[model samples]
Target chain A: MTSPARQLRGKDERAPVALSDRAMDNLRFIRETMERSASFTHVSGIGGVAMGLVAVAAAWAASRTTSDGAWLSIWLGAAGASFALSAFLMGRKSRAEGVALLSGPGRRFAWSMTPALAAGGVLTAALARGGHFGLLPGTWLLLYGASIVTGGSHSVRPVPVMGMAFMLAGVAALASPPAWGDAYMAAAFGGLHVVFGLLIWRKHGG
Target chain B: MAASSGAVRRRSLEPAERAPGNLDAVHGRTQESGPLELDQLIHERVRLGIVSALAVNGSLTFTDLRDLLGTTDGNLSAHARRLEDAGYVACKKSFDGRTPRTEYGLTEVGKRALNAYLDHMEAIIDATRE
Candidate 1:
């Protein structure tokens, strides 16, 4: 069967086309260029919210712990949950969008994000070893912020802004007293995640 | 079967339907016109979208193109076949475990044609604006 596209072409040929064919071509070219240059948009707002909730719970759990080791374990558990949730949600979004998980923009996002997370891990270990656990909150927030900012450079726009907000919270955490670490972590990771995650969902879609 | 073969023969004879490497005739026409003429094969909206998407994305599955263009399977398949016949696109058919998967990518000539088409459009816009 002649396709609908072919039928449409036949009709156009029999009539005086309203838009000159050349003009149509120009429009299509502009649109396609823009589409091609856009970043991968599979990041999930719901995933961010989920991570935020986990962070908040981790903060609450850490507060109840008597030892720094137990506190670290709770936060570490939150980190693992966040990673898994983010990956699962991102994969779902990619599939829904018909984009591969390892597409060009996705690869760029991953490449830009890995180093910051690695640094965060190294710093966490070293700080814990040296018993300078109070610095952990600031370092975590700063590095996480740096990761988001760097990755967001390759992702949608709001991500970098969120990253900057996390960085500012990190700076505040650093300057505050050691006793305030849990509260600052809660604000940065928990509050910021929920707020910005909602913003991303509203602006960029789920 | 006879009708299908006849359609193929007609497609083969059309000047605009020339294969990619044999684009000298089309280019010669463009040189005569002062600006390149757009490839009618790539000019239609659905076809244009398919080529444009493939030009940017290294490769896309049949489902990917269908979803991107919001077209029916029959529609996408027909258009894709036309592009493939023109030597403008390369198609790879494979099995992903239990299901068949078809992927499409722009051929080198296809890329050249798209670039030329864009340049022609730009030139027309420039001429009209002036």
Candidate 2:
């Protein structure tokens, strides 16, 4: 009911500021800074599950192919699709959290993962060029695991663990016969993704 | 002229003696209320920002702290120096390749002080609600 000018004069007559307002301002400042400094841990669980499903399908389709070229084509298609899906879902999650998809911790996460993924890409091309088709699964799993471990360092707990699981599967694939390659891909990419995806969803709110 | 000069000296000394401009002032301000004392050192805007950031991030480079707080080099250094002098923060000087890096972190004393400060603020909010 007080006039604006009267309220201003009344406030001036009192202490320079109210303690409650000052405290509230300080708390808000602290919260915003903490949020800014936090790592981007919103790697999507649903996205991971979806990627797993796609990988499973790719493995099935690949197993039925007559030529090595056809097998590679199926997997490459799945990788592309999975990457797109994960990126889209991650972007959505970032938006929901009111965080930028490409700034701060998100940028750090991407930077950490880049080298391993780049290595994977180059190795994939070189191995394929050499007609080293049997080595593809182990190489893919190992390098992809390396990428996850590095990137997931900036994400949640299960992410790096998932990467380690992939690395273990890669070691197994490398030690086992080439005939077991598809199975290792299925277990590592499909199974690992689904299991850890569920964990991340439950723990991190999907 | 001697009396006038003496008066000026006394006047300057009065403010310094009365204010003291540190923990004593903080104590005097809070003496009015029994439970409303705040750590004036950390109550400052920029210093509070520095402490809060370090509390969350564990450690931050000087550049990171400055950029995060949107403060200048001189301002940040001054405030950070105050915190370090109080034993509330620690500073490490290192080199990244050829570039010099200064990292700052909240010490144990600082963490406890921040916790106390937070508790005091929450108490104020709660008391006001009543």
Candidate 3:
């Protein structure tokens, strides 16, 4: 079916000089160029899968730890390691693709995502200070998901979808018993990452 | 000359439908033309593409812009030179090792022009829909 714009264009032979179908075409071209420029296209799919693997390992290690401190330490270490690995991989991919890592859309993406992550850091300290160990996983997932959702607005399509999945898992973790926290982390961080990572890899390329 | 001026005034006042071919009749020559009239400079396809792409990007290398637009080197060069001359675009030339790199960016004047152009197009769409 022809669009409303097309219909409008077709309705008038008398109005050809101004406000023609050519104007619509120009608008479409400009809109498309802006959208492409705004999209953060440097997300590393392989990095995502590798991060998931690290999360899975961290979850296993956390489960084996008898003390809450040790569990937190294990997960924190994993988080840092995962971040470094993802940064390295994403940088490599961006270089290979000839897209600057910290310019244009990438800069916008980082700006959008930074606030939630900063809040997460602040809240993590606050919660741990209060001995609220069980709440950590839920808080982490929720904030991380929020970051992804906000930043993913400037990223490829699937990034936001993955953010939504993380959010659902966060909600589930919050509702379930504290003993089930690690499992939820496994499912959301590990499983979702691998699934979406593979999909992004195949679709957007590694 | 007096009779000719009178005829021109009369034609300008005539209904737009009666003078479809006459732009000056439908949208008369004025100190400030409304949004229905498109900016002639950015109206062309290739030039419009260059401006639109530069609007969102911080800067783009000549090679990058050519690849993005899918245009040949000479064609891109000619259009880019036009924009550069219009003060709507800025060009920077530098060397990356042995290779010389030419980068292009949109100027502030260009940004305002593009914004005005976009406003005009949007106004057209809104008018059409109505």
CA shift of B88, model 1, Å: 20
Better of 2 and 3 by lDDT: 2
TM-score per model over all chains: 0.57, 0.58, 0.56
TM-score of chain B of 1: 0.74
Q: What are the candidates' individual DockQ scores?
A: 0.06, 0.23, 0.20
Better TM-score candidate (2, 3): 2
Clashing pairs in 1: none
CAPRI-style docking class of model 3 based on DockQ: incorrect
lDDT value, candidate 3, whole model:
0.78
lDDT (tens digit, per residue) of candidate 1 on A24-140: 555766475537544767788888888899888888889899899999989998899999999999898889888898777788788888999999999999999999999999999
The C-alpha lDDT values of all candidates are 0.76, 0.79, 0.78
Question: Model 1: per-residue lDDT, tens digit, B1-130?
Answer: 2222221122222333351222222211333554344477876777888888887667788988888788999999999999999999999999999899999999999999888777645543443332
lDDT of 2 by residue, A1-206 (tens): 75686477643232212434555777888887776766667799999999999999999889888899999999999999999999999999989988789876788889999999899899989999999989999999998999999988877779999999998898889988988888889988999999999999988867
User: Candidate 2 on B22-89: residue-level lDDT in tens?
Assistant: 22122123435443435877878899899998997768899988988999999999999999999999
lDDT of 2 at A146: 92
Q: After superposition, how far is residue A135 of candidate 1 from its true place, in Å?
A: 0.3
| Rank order (by lDDT, best first) | 2, 3, 1
RMSD (Å) of each candidate, 1 decimal: 16.2, 12.8, 13.7
